[model samples]
Target: MQHFLNSSFTIPAERNEQLESLLKIHCHVFPYPAKTKFLEYGDAMDGVYYVFQGRTKHYILAEDGAEKILYCLSSGWFFGETPLTLHEPTGLISETMEPSILWKIPYSVYDKLLDVNKLFRTAIMNCMSRKMLIMRHEIENQVFNPCKQRILQLLCSTVDNASLVEGKWYNLSSHYTQYEISTIIGSARVTTSKLINELCNEGFIRILNRKLQVSKIIYEEITDQMDLL
Candidate 1:
């Protein structure tokens, strides 16, 4: 499989030395299969993780056993910070969405790197702030956005913006089922299904096989509607 990080994203050069340092210490490459749980809710975290390939989901299990996805992350995204920072059990479950490769940096080495690497510290701080902002946006979308708008935003989030065909298509459905999409957007299954159909009818989105193809025109329309809201 192509490395998503190499295709459309590159790690910032400033953090290369820090990454190298971890490589020399406790960091090691690990592979995980789809649906494999790296950390369960309340499980103790042993380290921090960096995704080098494929996708993963950070979620919570509801009382009913349903997974409520908080974030779907691909290459360059890091995890295990909440537990590492608190020195406690993980609050959310982290699982693979696809066959994935990750670099695990044991907590002891993680602390050493943070103490000596200003650039790494800055990058991690920025990542944490971004994660918080994304959480806020997710909550706001669920509370205030219509199902159609919510779905549009969710689909757009998966776009490979650095690719040549970036805005023209998104392979979102390949990564998530309709039910999972509904859960992420906080919509009922019926509502999500109906809005998906409406989007297709309105020429706002098209699904070939499971890939969601999004046109620039539809993207502009979604943006305009969001602006109005």
Candidate 2:
């Protein structure tokens, strides 16, 4: 697969050096190709991955064997925090969306490092906190927002130039179909396809060569409507 997520998402400025140092401390480093299943639900991982490069998705496979994406993680992020607390493997399967660079941390080593280094502890806390906040907003977006508005918000959060675009179009770098969009929005793909088509016809958004463009006026309207959702 040719993955296209933003590859240059850098570490937060305040902690860039700290993250680099952590990478230096790590004993295992692996490069994963796009579409690789990096980690699975309930599989033990000794170290949290410090994502030096690439993108990944967090999702759960249902009992019926359907995968549902919960979040997208880009560069500068880490995975495996959830399992750290429970002393078990994560329930979410992580798949590489881009060819990725990862520095693995053994659980015991990270624990010792965190105890010896205040920065590591702070980094973990900040990362987990941000995760929680994003998840909270996701729940609200899924539960209350209309499909169009939710799509608008998702684009706003992930896409660049969201505030200035005049047309109803966007080109997401990720490869996702209407079916995946429906799964994310908890709707049928037909409903999602219809909504997208309508948005195009109504001049709210448009698809051009697989690019998504949203009118600035419509974007504002959607944002306003979002508050009411």
Q: Cα lDDT of all candidates, in order? A: 0.69, 0.66
On the 0 to 100 scale, the lDDT of residue 43 in model 1 is 87
Query: Taking the tens digit of each residue's C-alpha lDDT, what string does model 2 give over 1-229?
Result: 0011111122132337766776676648889998899788778867787777777777887787666677767766767866875688778888887798877888888888778988777777888876776666667766777877665555544444433443534444344567666666556677788988887788876666676765666655655664565
Model 2 misplaced stretches (Cα beyond 4 Å): 1-15, 162-175, 220-229
Candidate 1, 49: how far from true, in Å? 1.0
TM-score of each: 0.82, 0.80
Query: Cα deviation of 52 in candidate 2 (Å)?
Result: 1.2
Model 1 per-residue lDDT at 32: 94
Report how far residue 71 has shifted in candidate 2, in Å. Answer: 0.9
Report the Cα lDDT for residue 8, model 2: 15
Name the candidate that leads on TM-score.
1
The model with the greatest lDDT is 1
The residue-level lDDT of candidate 2 at 80 comes to 89
Q: How far is 143's C-alpha from truth in model 2 (Å)?
A: 2.7
